[model samples]
Target: MPDPVLLVLDTAPSPRLGRLTGRVDVRHADASSLAGLLPAADVLLVWDAASDAVRAAWPGPGRRPGWVHTAGVRVDRVLCPELAASDTVLTNARGVFERPVAEYVAGLVLAFAKDLPGAPELRGRARHREVQQVAGARAVVVGAGPVGREITRLLHGLGVRVALVGRTARRTIHGAADLDRLAARADWVIAAVPLTDATRGMFDRRFFGLLQPSARFISVGPVACVVRSGLQDALERRWFAGAALDVSEGEPPGPDGPSRDVPGLLLSPYPSGATVGWRDRLGEQFVALYEQWARGEPLPNVVDKERGYVPSADLPGGAGPDPGTGPRVNGSAAPPG
Candidate 1:
């Protein structure tokens, strides 16, 4: 029997798939060539998780891959109506990012509290300013997923009170309804939810207005979840103390972008989850999942195409079980690919 064709949507440093060389026939494609190569592929590995090629090409393809996996946690970039409605199973790099991103959020909380971003400037100007304390601060971490849970755990270790909000209320996890009330009193409000119909533009003027004037905002989620203009206006008007965004809607604005001059605003080009050796880790993760698929066993991190995320049963007083293991799969059996 011919080896299952594994098509990779290539990126700068391609995933090292040497382990699969003998077991799979691997092919590479870019945005332009992706559609042409989709038909024969038994499995599609979206190595360039940031690209929208899958969304654009998936709808125009012949037979789509039996299983499609993205190396990123958020599947919105690759999800489209066609793929979502098909029998093809979709999965993401869920376990790989939780810890790194949570650590990044913790760092941002500390940086904001200590005003670390302004320290160099203060030294250069011979000026002094007082900074807030992180311990005893209150935080509202939206999204009850692994990343959010990790953030909550890290913040608690720092002596900060954290309110973890999810789609619905459960033991120790607040529901979406409590977000407004919680944000109003929080010292730090973090957006960690995935981008879905319900979450897109969730952080708008009203939500920003709900924050305390001295509070800080941090978003490690997709850029679309926050309204850029609303955040800009809020910062300019001092509605909140400050904000740090790791993701941007498009090509992040250049140095002269409109938000550049906005005081108390910091922007990073989506690097929260991208620690050193992240790509290699993602490669290893996909390889492991592929092996599971080859054995016709249940694949972990299988995304619910309709909902756009991996659904998990809520655990009492927590975000759920170990995310590295993730939710169990039931009917995702398929021939070795």
Candidate 2:
């Protein structure tokens, strides 16, 4: 058989595919060139995890790849009807980002609790003050996936109380019904949930209203009312005490750009998964999975496309499903994707 043609949707400092150079037929394409390149490829490595090029170009009349892999966790920007309905298999770099993102959350919690950003200004003015305590603080973490669980663990280590909420109830995890009540009592509300219809606008007006005025909301993925303008509105109206948004609906200001001008609204360029050598980590992960695919082995981190993410039950070595919910197969028997 011929070497599998691996078409990588290119991004800067492209994937270090040197390991597979001679073993696979590697091709490169960007948004403008993806459409013409899709037909002949046997596999597509969506290296540009944030691009919508794959969604826009996947439906054209031609043979599609047998497998698609994204370098990141969330698959929202790449999923479309054609790709979702096809027999083509989809995979993601799920475990790659969990701890790094969780650590970022911990840093945010510390920054907010200790008022790190305001420290320089206060020091310059020689002002002394007391900041709130992180230990003994209450946190409500949404999403029960690996990333969410890791965040909960880190926060718990810091002596913060945490209530973990997921799509449905399980042994120790809370279900969706308790979110509002939990948020009402929490000092911090951290969202690590995937972007599905069920979770998309789940944090809108009513959700924000449930948070304590002193609560700080931080989202690793997209959250409703946490986007650019929405955050501005919340700050202007004094809806909540403060917030940290890692993902937003619009471009973030550049490094030398003006201040957001809105107090208590922290903005980050979505670097939750961007630790040093992280891209290299992702490349190494893809190469290992690629080797498995080349040998026809059962792949890990298979995404339940219909659900838009890799279901918790489908994670590598995941326990077969929560007792109440039936076995998770392609998310067909699971809750809303």
Candidate 3:
């Protein structure tokens, strides 16, 4: 058999992909080039999950790859009818980002709760202040994916009351309808949802208006979830305390991104997952998946195509084992890919 070919659909640094060269064939393609090159590869790593290229170019005249993996956790940007119905397997780098992102959100919560952003001025003064308890504060976390669950656990550890909202109503989680109640009462509103037709632009003026004036909204999902004008207007009028966003529909701000000069807002350049050990972890995940493939075993974290991703039923926490062992696929049931 020929060497396995993996097509990467994002702007990957040259050095980052050097390791895959010797074991698996690696090819790079952007959104514009995906259609012409997809048919030849055995796997596709969607580094840019938001790219519509795959969906636009899909339903080609022939067979597609055996498996597809997204670098990002959310599948809203990549899945469409053609890819969803195909038997070709799909997966995501589920655990790769959960903790780092959770940590980031925790930090943001801490910063807001402790008033750390206001520290610079206070440090010069001799006056002291009262520190508030982040513990026991109510946090309404939207989205029940692996990322949301991890965030929930982390928040619980921080003494925050967390309410998880998924597509369905569950014993432990609330459904979409309950979101308004949670948001209205929450001290912190964290949006960690996957982008779906139902979720796009869901955080509009009305959504922001529903929040208590003291609430803070932090978005960790795609940009479209919160409309630009809505959020900006909220900040402009102090409708809400502030927002910290790690993902955006239009990054680079001026290019249709949120171009606001709103006070109390904190933003980053999508650095939530850019941690020191991230690269090694990525390599580790792929290594474990490759091991399973070489042994003719099933994979972990398979994407559902129709549903965007399939969490491995084999996982104890729905995210598999710890990160150190490269995704913990050392058991039966072939692991989910």
Top candidate on TM-score is: 1
Q: Please report, in order, the local distance difference test score of every candidate based on alpha carbons.
A: 0.80, 0.77, 0.73
- After superposition, the stretches of candidate 3 with alpha carbons farther than 4 Å from their true spots are 13-23, 30-33, 48-52, 123-131, 248-250, 311-315, 318-337
Per-residue CA lDDT of candidate 2, range 76-121, in tens? 8788888988989999988888888888999999998888888777
- Over all chains combined, what TM-score does candidate 2 have? 0.88
What is the full ranking by TM-score, best candidate first?
1, 2, 3
Which segments of candidate 2 are over 4 A away from where they belong? 13-15, 60-62, 123-126, 223-230, 247-259, 314-337
Provide TM-scores for the models: 0.89, 0.88, 0.84
Q: Please, what's the RMSD in Å of model 2?
A: 4.8
Candidate 3 residues 224-313, lDDT tens each? 777988898888899888898884433556756666466877886566876787756766676677668757899888765554555433
Cα displacement (Å) at residue 203, model 2 = 1.7
Candidate 1, 1-337: lDDT as tens digits: 9999999997664556888989999999999999889988999998888788998888444577999999898889999999998889999998888888888888989988887787777755645567788988999889877777777777877888788787877556777888899999999998888889888989999999999999999988887788889999999999999998875333366643335667898877557788899889998999899999999998888887777787655322343333334221122111000
Over all chains combined, what TM-score does candidate 1 have?
0.89
> Taking the candidates one at a time, how many backbone clashes does each contain?
0, 1, 10
